[model samples]
Target: MSRLLTAAAVAVTLLFSQNALAEKVSVEELQTGLDHPWAVAFLPDNQGMLITERSGSLRYWRQGKGLSQPIIGVPKVWAERQGGLLDVVLAPDFTQSRRVWLTWTEVDNNGRAGAVVGYGTLSDDNARLTRVKTVLRQQPALSSGANLGSRIAFDGDGFVWITFGDNFHAETAQDLSALTGKIVRLNADGSVPQDNPFVNKTGARPEIWALGVRNPQGIALNPWTQEIWESEHGPRGGDEVNIPRKGKNYGWPLATWGLDYSGEKVPGSKGGEVAGTEQPAFWWKVSPAISGMAFYNSARFPQWKNSLFIGALKEKNLIHLSVNGDRVTEKERLLSDRGERIRDVRMGPDGYLYVLTDERNGKLLKVGLAE
Candidate 1:
């Protein structure tokens, strides 16, 4: 019996030691004094990056040159609670086209607000945006400032994808005609894709690719499979990671593992499962308030290859997820010592990880393997 106990202790000790080694990372502050930075997009050939701030400013940053003043010609945004400039991404053919896309909250004349996507050409000198035009806007806009999922991603086929939250109206998630709480697919020019699942369905918005999501804040294209992975916040608990498929329904208020903040069951949910709705690939029973996500496909950290890194807002940690095929397990939580609200995380072209902290004086951080 003593021999067995000794073996168990050794095994436990080895497990903990391995985890500690795996979590060792070096974080370096790249740029400081950003005002509530929301997202970051790398420029071609490492020329620079485009970053969006929640207060409606877009800044450029490059190594050694430091940060540039806000580029001119950015459209006026609502910039209200949980609103403002959100996501920025380069067009798939940006190198030749100099085209960029942006998403933000905009208000209508009646005080109703919704998320909108626009595109413009980044001037050769990177001084301002030119030839700017709005493309897509969410329908049935509401007054609520919560749950505006505005993440943008491009598929292998160069299709543009956008996520929309329910705007605090949970029931609208299941509504086919409403743009709220859904994923929409479109051509690079903002035209609806005819091959979309709902293009031929009556009373259904033709642009919708998937439905029934809460406040999805993270969306990324898997470097290996090219599949899009999304992460979203649940009401009180039930933060979820999902791979949204064409026309699939991800159970939101209709069926969730989360409860209302008031400790009551979600109003319409029967439970965490429903007959027609798809289950999340992974879920958190206690909400992490997840945000941006990225897949580590670089050799900069060989041990971290193929791992998925997600930012945690409420928990203030970087959640490392070990992914195999479609199955994922929580490998560890990192950067808890920093105690900042992680707004966005992305793998950089230099084979390192870049993180954005949401704060009055936000920071851009570069993370690499500890030597």
Candidate 2:
């Protein structure tokens, strides 16, 4: 018995030692002092980047130079808890059109606010946005404050996918008639695609591509598989990563692996196994508050090529997951407590992993393999 116990201790020690080694290659901070930065996108022609802050401002960054002054002409925003100016994406044909998309919280009738997606044209210098127009808006605005999980991704097909939260209305997730807690597909001009799953269905929101999500803050498209993936925050535990499919229900408030914040039983049970709802590709038992995700397609991180990198706001780290086709086989936690909240992760054009920190004074960090 003593021999067996000794062997077990040695095995545990080796496991911890391996994890520590993996954490060593992470990059230290390169720049700092950004103000509550949310989303980041690279310019197609140059090495500079455009970044958005939660306070309704946009800033520019060049390679050697630091952050530029807040770019003017951003639309006025309704900044509130979990709301305000959010994501930004460059058009695929940006060289010719100079178009960009933005998502934010907008105040509507009845003095309530909801999420909205819009488009704009970049100025001659690419430093300012002009001709802003609303492309999509959430319906039946909620009266109280809650989750607004807004993230956007542009598929190669020229269509855009937008993910919405339940707005604290858990029951709204299962309701296809509403736009809350759903993945919506839209054309470049913010119109619903004619081939959407529910375009012809009566009483359903024509923009809905999939339904039944909680607070899906992270959305990305896998360049290799052409698949759409999302990461969402669960009630207290059950943080989930899902590959959304059209017309399928995702089993939100009605079913979950997580419990309520008070530790009481959730409505539907441990997992979503109902007749029509789909299951998550991966789920974390202890909630990490996943905020951003990107698939590593760069050649610089050869070992991480085709793997998914996720930003964890609650844990303040980057969570790396290995993907075999559609399934997540393993996970590694990186940069734990080394920085503040990680808001976004992207594979840069320069063949390095770029990260945006979320805080009153955030940072733009670059990660690559160590020498």
Identify the candidate with maximal lDDT: 1
- Please identify model 1 stretches exceeding 4 Å from their true place: 1-21
lDDT of 1 by residue, 173-270 (tens): 99999999998899999999889999999999999999999999999998888888899999999999999999999988888999999999989988
TM-score of each: 0.94, 0.91
- List, residue by residue over 1-371, the lDDT tens digit for candidate 2: 11011211111111112253353344645457676778989988666888888888887777556667777788888887778888998888888888888888887766677788898998867678888888888876662556788899999898899988998888888888887899999988788899999999999999999998988889999887898899999998988999999888888987788888889877655454665677899988898888889888877657776689889898888888888888895467776747578889888887777888888777777776664
RMSD of 1: 8.9
Error of 1 at 55 (Å): 0.3
Q: Which candidate gets the maximum TM-score versus the true structure?
A: 1
Report the Cα RMSD per candidate: 8.9, 8.8
lDDT (0 to 1) per candidate: 0.88, 0.80
